[model samples]
Target: MLYNLFNKVSSMNKFAALTKHFAAAVFWGCMMAVPGWAQSPGGTEKELIRLQNEWATARIKGDVAFLENLYAKEFRITAMNGSVVERDADIAVFASREMKPELITDEDMKVSLYGEVAVVTGRENLKGTYKGIPGEFALRFTNVFVRRDGHWQLVTHHSTEMRKK
Candidate 1:
């Protein structure tokens, strides 16, 4: 009788181990099938920051084509003067020789992610030529990004000049 009881307990222990292994396998399988399920909040934030840096680099290089790929179809921007620029116009401005951005830097950025949407707020310090006029400006900017088709796209942007204290 003692041998039989020991055998039963050993069987139960084996079953429990099997159940645990099965549960872990199922969880990992689901994560593999669903792209969103596998991503962590920290990973999302890092990807968003990387995209922002890519955008800044594109601006410095005057690579509007690269920016176009990163922007959404209905992308828009509000200038420091409160003027709204649509997708085509924004690309045009960037493509223009007069809008040369010698230096484009993002500083003190705060990035927040909510599911598929992200908001980034930061200071953009620009040293460039505007219509043959060399000037420098520091602006506080907010850029909104949304995840679509497994990629993040910039949908909206707004900037306001940073005034002297």
Candidate 2:
């Protein structure tokens, strides 16, 4: 019948309009997600900075346990003296009786985020003593951190002592 055909055609048109609206909603939702994803890196950068400071504080206080928790299991640091410092070695330094940090400060710290990895570069001015040898140095350092299990841990560190100008 003509009336039946008209009703069926109207229903089809209604279904098409609903589909269009649903598609539009999904499209806009995805568009909003992009910006949210982009903004997430900003939070990560701030967190990395905070972690950097905390690491420095732990070093100054000789908090070996804290450093152990923050560092990855395979963490390694190439020191300014060209010594490859592994996790256990560094923890030993923190636990040493002769080496004690008097002042540990960082400056000009910058962090770059690559997905779940963050690279931090900064200047560290340290005043300390190791084995009765004065440890006063200005160094530029790079620290690589990775996010795992919703926590950031330092994976690698390399530092070069900056010569006096």
Which one is best on lDDT? 2
Residue runs of model 2 more than 4 Å from their true location after superposition: 1-38
lDDT of 2 by residue, 61-99 (tens): 888889889999999999888989899888888878467
| Model 1, residue 71: C-alpha shift (Å) | 1.0
Residue pairs of candidate 1 with colliding backbone atoms = none
lDDT of all the models against the reference? Answer: 0.86, 0.87
What lDDT tens digits, residue by residue, belong to model 1 across residues 1-165? Answer: 966865777777978977999999999998887666226877787788888888988877879888889999999999999999998887887788658888888888888887678999999898988888998999999999998888989999999999988
Residue 147 lDDT, candidate 1, scale 0-100: 88
lDDT of 1: 0.86
Q: Any residue pairs clashing in model 2, and if so which? A: none
For model 2, what is the error of residue 42's alpha carbon versus the real structure, in angstroms, after optimal superposition? 2.4
Question: What does candidate 2 score in Cα RMSD to the true structure?
Answer: 5.5
